[model samples]
Target: MENTKSRKQPSTVFAVVSFIAIVAVLIIMINLGVNTTLSVFAGVIMAVIVTALLGIPWKETEKNIISVAADCMPTFLIVIMVGMLVGIWMASGTVPSLMYYGMQIISPKILVPLAFVLCGLTSEFTGTSFGSVATMGLAMVGIASTTSIPIPLVVGAIVSGAWLGDKMSPLSDTTNLASGVSKVGLYDHIHSMMYTTLPAGIVALILFTIAGLHYGGNMDTAQQQLIMNTLADNFHISLILILPCILVILISVFRLPSLLGMGLAVVISTIFGLVFQGVGFVQLMDYAFNGFSIKTGVAIVDPMLNRGGVLSMSELLVTFMIASVMGAIITTSGILDVLAKNVLLKFIKNKSILVLVTLIYCYIVNFLTAGGQTVAIIVTEQTFETTYKDMNISRRVLSRTLEDAGTLSAPIVPWGVATIYVMGVLGCSNAYIPYAWFIFIVPIFSMVCAITGIGMWDADEKPLRTKKA
Candidate 1:
């Protein structure tokens, strides 16, 4: 499908009303306690109706929706594969081994910063904040509970670390989606994010270190030992168990195709599960489809280990489809174009204001859309691409900004899907918001980068463009 330029642009009134109507429906439906899937579907209906009212043909609108959805097919595949990878890694003892070793080495003095770093590493490796939170993040919570450390502080650290992976990981769907929609290379997008991510990470580490030192806990080493023992007793504990993870890292470093790398890694992990865990082929297949389950006779460890599967990704797949439909209709109907040209563009004439406004727009969409990063990134990119081109800025900056704001903002919104899912998994309260230092710091750091033109490129410079989404 071509760009929306060929489509008839609605008048400013029609465009503004259409955009507001969709947003209003989303806000109302979400506030009314409807499920996110339902809320987004309602938004889609509202967008379709608005476009019809604006005199766009239904068939044309449908074509646009289908085109956009097709573009998201790769994302859909990646998410499903991610669910599979998570399940296999768990069944193969890869994740459990990491958790066991991580718990053993994390001293009370470094527990807080270690929590951030460990969760970040897991998330970066897995490429899903929810996965990292559900697995290693839960472990952090368990560790904190056994110590005198504050659960909220640990939860904050986990959230911060999880988002680091979510933003920078090549396996991350949000990272890929942001880079994809912005028409930038995946590694390029990840590389650009380091400008803000690095400094924010350093600052967050300092804060976590200070907080840990001041309010440090008297850790119960016995509980930690128990966790390690239980893991060892239940699964084959070996450094070689993490070969799949190393495989993924190597693939990322080599700059190979992400889906291919992850797909092969999942197969290798499944094989490891069969060989080391001594499960039969049938059981491995079951685990791949329905997720791994661990009883371990230990209530706390069971939840941490028993997660992942192709089925686990179904909700996200549906949610992605719904959000994409709404976005597609908005773009196809030319409402995005109208609003951009008449409304947003009027104020974001300068590059500095453009970056700030884009960041703000990403946040608004993220929260209001209930924390679907794909919708925020794609819609933000689609709405602002022309403006960025007009201002002669690089699309890599746009991709980075999306990661900084859109990808990072999801977990901080108390009611957003990412926050709710992570909190539920880690058993942490929204009070951890103040402590999620990395995600919060990144956007501010990015804004400062924009103001200083630190990582951004001018029109006259080499433009970082890729094949259009």
Candidate 2:
């Protein structure tokens, strides 16, 4: 901790100025079509310059950077594995089966609501919104195109379902990061989130139900026939193909490690790919690293299937590294805390305001940092843990807030990795943002709960902060 001793804390004014400048630069560059990776690099350069001007030694900054990166390494691995899971599952026809069967079952009358719920379940099982969107979401979009329902509405249902699943899933990297960073157990974190998630999910479903009823109609039978035929021609759609999904659910039900479960699913899918899909072992390996390619003559379906592989996640990984470096540099300079103490915490004395501030902080991090949920969680937890302790708030509450904002907000921010990936996969525009019902509801519900102390630990409970309590 000698490095900690060597750093000089900048005044609140300097800290605020530095933050605004960095955020402004990032936003301008991103909007100008500069790559998000480059924007993060620019932010890091600014952060380092601030540290140097503050007289903090570069070695101390290096140590902080390494420490934060080390903390994030597990999340990186999980995300990479999630990429592989998508690749293997898609190649194995597990995902294809799900899409085919899902399309076959849902009638136009209940399409929107069921699509939302189905995508949610798929994402919850897969633990990645990107994966859910690339597969199930793509299928929904393709199916919706043949109907009179608005594409934005369909995209909205898909995003709403996918993000909600990502928020609650035990296998989700964001969920794990939030809980781990906040020193809460994984199951405990998910359980706590249900208070807000369940209510918001129900509300979202109701809205979707109303939308489906209004927009529901008979889609072109010829178009639906062609899509189903393409899926059948390409994949060996069968009940057995659903096992991988079942395996993931069982793993989560039994409280197993997500890495293990996702890895197992990948292995099983790989074997299935070889045995059923006739994908060779060498090809399977290629698909795991480089992703699966679909050559179906159908235009709408090909893009949806053209996803997965470790390489596909390269952009996200680079974004993660760059943002982590920026966060580390700012943290090392001690500006993050100074700004937090003087600017954020100055007026946040009570639980209600504190909760709102935490939510806002997480959202700001997502927007400014390009929506790295793990980065947001780590930063928010580091910034707010002490405040929560002093306020007698439970860490579970902190965990829930981190997700309610950080995880949920990512898919709404146009430049966020999750949003970009989902949009790219679904081939939809930002028109869906206004329709992403669940994403908007959870945070508002969280703020309401915080103000009323609903679902929060009692202030007088001695063991309120304990994991087992």
Candidate 3:
């Protein structure tokens, strides 16, 4: 009893210490105006210190550290590959062609909402937010600049749409990861998500439409046409560029592994680059490593288009490392267990409180770790598995909660991977966007569904009941 009590005490101490440290770092980060990467690194270091001081075995802690690193490797590799693919696609005129056509169809009044809709379509088809952002999203930035619309608003629309598609699309890696982690069927998961996702999307569209109607008339047609023409002249725009996008969509619709599908798309793009764009073997290699650049003699255009490379992976990697380590510490030291038992579960009684508390906890975890949506889902799954099971809630309920809070809220947090990347690409400050309707609305919508018991099913509540043993 003495030894067991001693162990419990250290665990309790560690939980308290880590929680305090995390709060302190959040306050300091806010005061200092530090970016998410720095804040996450500080939190991780503090967590490690707390864990050590509380007597977590060094070997056990080290194992978790290594596991975090290994789990993150696929993301790092995907980031690098995506960067290279973007570079090549840009150089080959694939993205430019799509943009040229997109610009022709867009009117100033519909630009903002259209940006959302278009990005949503592309991300759905491609099953990649990063790929959509690199290609057509970059074009939208140019279009937004020409139209005098706020960049952050445009970025918000883009992110909102991109993530919407990511959540719904069968091909998205995160979508697969979420379902896989929850042990839910892919179709069932996608279907279940729609209850929350569709409403959020509709709300987002309405908001973007209203904003567009107010700001669309101020767009400069001459400048927009000029940008389109410049893109057209720089790269060979044609019907063929659409093929790679189609291939991506088809593969995704079939629900193949995302890596394999994306790899196939890359191969198709490379072939097109060689045959139609006259890209040489040497240039192809360079584009994959260093990214593609267009010397358009236009200063803004050059920088806007000349991005994406293997080197771009470093910053994201650093942020992930810090966030993952912090998460590892939090889990290993039993901080989450303590919080779940003493605070969250204690206060959560019925479905309303359950949903709200889960949402709050998921968001807090996402904010503290600065990790992506996948990490958020992983944490929530582990943290709430028992609670959810005990409450007789279907795993889909937890999955829905994860997406509503974790996936949608990621882009709003300044330090989160989605927010940071969008800001970097669009050159928009996080605070400039007054309203992110989708991010704000999805959680509310999800909770309402939960409270009403519209989408939830108790484990034993199924119609085709199993016989008792």
Candidate 4:
């Protein structure tokens, strides 16, 4: 038995080492200005190395690769559809009308907080940070350009609001994933997160509001009106466009599947486009694939409103592929397992340390994976479930930590899926935004709550009794 274990250990170590080397090479290539396509190739190589090193039967790894590919196929279709939806919506005047109204309400003095609230509302309704950013959040960027606000800060506020809603909303995939992985009830997880999420959101709003009042500069009303008029010329703007968004919110509130809810919204938007804008089938198809382009002959407005389509999903696809493959390799190599055994388990002796360590580990996993928020929550929950139980801590606490750290941190990491999508739509860099104040503050605030036992259930709580029994 000892010899068998020893043989396995070497394979695991070799697998981890090889995976790390590939990642390092990819990083170097990226630093050296190699195209993103090459970076994805590097990730694929790393995945193969991990499969080989895991000592799984060679045929099995090949099968797994096929499975992974198959699983990813639907994502491609969804991405394409999303692109088309965005394009049609833009060309149909849905987006422009929304933007026109948004611009009328927002001035530089209130842009930051207003953006936060708007993004927050949209994300909650959409249940997808990516969808919200791609649609309305993109419009916010155009609106911001008419003001003297710092672009990055505006981007940050948008990110902050979107992620906050995504983390807290019952409809969010990450929220469900955290609860599911931890074996906690969905409502319980959401209720627990409110302790941290609400405080952080309030703080973020206050900070953004202050910044808007003090640092936000004047707006060019002429330029803003010009952009609005250009939008009016292309598509029919009406209150009817608001129905799709409202339908999304209603479906989400009923706890419907996120994909279904989003798909419904897409259908509504398409119908609205066809009926109101006289959009042809060919045009709709073209818009979805190539994105909507507005030829206003005005350089700035064209670029701003002329983006959306399956093609826009390219950067996001690459980012997801890289991060997912890396995560798969990490799982296969047992490096993550070893880290949890050696590092995470060691914290079980101290209640406070265990919570702190779990929070930190979840945060690091999110940063490294840069994939979906679900990946971090699942990994962290699996890593620490036994420890939490052993320490008599509630799983809800763990679930809460997962949200506060993992779910909220995705948008701050440049290569992360949310960040890449947001940046692509906004036409900015991830680094452009100051680290979202909410993202930075939420985890710290949550850790404080955990250590001080502020929001934690009492040891004698009924849930603990049921769990222990």
Candidate 3 Cα outliers beyond 4 Å, as residue runs: 1-17, 30-36, 180-183, 424-435, 462-469
- lDDT (0-100) at residue 223 of candidate 1? 71
| Runs in model 2 lying further than 4 Å from the true structure | 1-7, 122-142, 148-152, 169-195, 214-218, 385-399, 420-432, 462-469
**What clash count goes with each model?**
0, 0, 0, 3
**Root-mean-square deviation (CA) per prediction:** 5.8, 4.4, 4.1, 3.8
User: If the candidates were sorted by their TM-score against the true structure, best first, what order would they fall in?
Assistant: 4, 3, 2, 1
Identify the leading candidate in terms of lDDT: 2
Residue 153, model 4, lDDT: 87
| Candidate numbers sorted by lDDT from highest down | 2, 1, 3, 4
Tens digit per residue, CA lDDT, model 3, 272-331? 888878889688768777777668876656765676665555576677677777777766
In TM-score terms, candidate 2 sits at 0.84
Model 1 misplaced regions, further than 4 Å: 1-21, 28-33, 118-159, 162-195, 211-218, 349-351, 364-403, 406-436, 450-458, 461-469
Assess the local accuracy of residue 261 in candidate 2 as a C-alpha lDDT between 0 and 100: 77
lDDT of 1: 0.76
lDDT tens digits, residue span 1-469, model 2: 7656766679999988988988888879878989867877888899888998888988778998899889868767877887787778788988778767766877887889988998899778877676567556766776676678998999999999999998888878789888898888899889889989999999999999999988877678787777778889998888799898778767766767767877888889899998889999999888888988989999967765777788877877887788778877876777667777788888886777888889988877776556767767888899999889888788889999999998898888765666656654555666788999998999888876776667677434334323212
Candidate 4 residue 229 Cα shift, in angstroms, is 2.4
1 versus 2: better TM-score goes to: 2
**Per-model TM values vs. the true structure:** 0.78, 0.84, 0.88, 0.88
Q: Determine which window of 10 residues in candidate 2 has minimal summed lDDT.
A: 460-469
Structure candidate 1, residue pairs in collision:
none
